[model samples]
Target: MEDKRAAVTALPALFADLVRCETRLYNALNDRLREQHGLTTAQYEILRYLHDHPEARVADLATEFAAGVGAISKGIDRMENLGWVERRPNPTDRRSSLLALSHNGSDLFDAAQKTFTTRLTELLADLPALTTVARTLAHLRTTLEDRRIGLPAG
Candidate 1:
């Protein structure tokens, strides 16, 4: 009773702290990327994912990114305009298209990847415990997924 109440009382504080940290980190990273490469964080992430999974279809990519179709479509349109990706008609599924990283996209990724890696590395270099951070973030993601919170309703 009292013990459970005490534990519950502490949970909000812990959760708030974790959320604040994650939000700050995300904003900072996005800002840095925008400053350096003129890309929004979401755009960069999408490009990276497409670069890695060139065979992924548009719907699959939207799901993988936990983003809405409209959002992904907008991003893809922008990427296409930037010559970073191309949409090819999926032979198996004529209705939906396959999104693949273009040659220029690959080249851009190769050129920017090192700088992105270096920046991320620098950000994490002074972290107190890398493993703990990874584990905590993984736990948070799993919890969110399990609760069906913050994810697009399929």
Candidate 2:
């Protein structure tokens, strides 16, 4: 354990740890969300965003989630088919439609949010310095988002 700890103390090792941790967390969350709410993580995220940004368009969601518009649109189509979301013509942009959560979507999101938090807490239960790590990650995420490095140009 001491040797392993020493190995991960370096920057590259820490980055590898971060990547693996993210993958594990995402897979667990995706599985749980799918089993409980019929939502993949990506779909749940779209619903969550629509809940917050009631007037979002596909482009807006793609931008917010760092996904391509085509991918976002397909997810939206699935949710809309499930009666979890609806698209209304964007008055401002004829080519894009504004996305909103349906009544079912809002209810599902409310329930799923509880599951998400509970599962996340369970997953992090034994981890040390969770608060500090969360804060640091938030800062990193904000900085990366602002820089938009490695992202495709719009």
Clashes of each: 0, 0
Stretches > 4 Å off in candidate 1: 1-4, 146-148
- Candidate 2 residues lying further than 4 Å off, grouped into runs, are 1-9
In candidate 1, what are the lDDT values of residues 1-154, reduced to their tens digit?
A: 9999999999999989888976876777788777877776677777788888887776777777777887788888899999988999999988888888899888777766766777778778788999898998899788877886776765
TM-score of every model? 0.83, 0.87
Per-residue CA lDDT of model 2 for 14-55, tens digit only, reads 788899999999999999999999888888888888988888
TM-score, structure 2 vs. true: 0.87
Candidate 2, lDDT over the whole model: 0.88
Candidate 1 similarity to native, TM-score: 0.83
Clashes, model 2: 0
Tell me how far the alpha carbon of residue 119 in candidate 1 is from the true structure, in angstroms, after superposition: 1.8
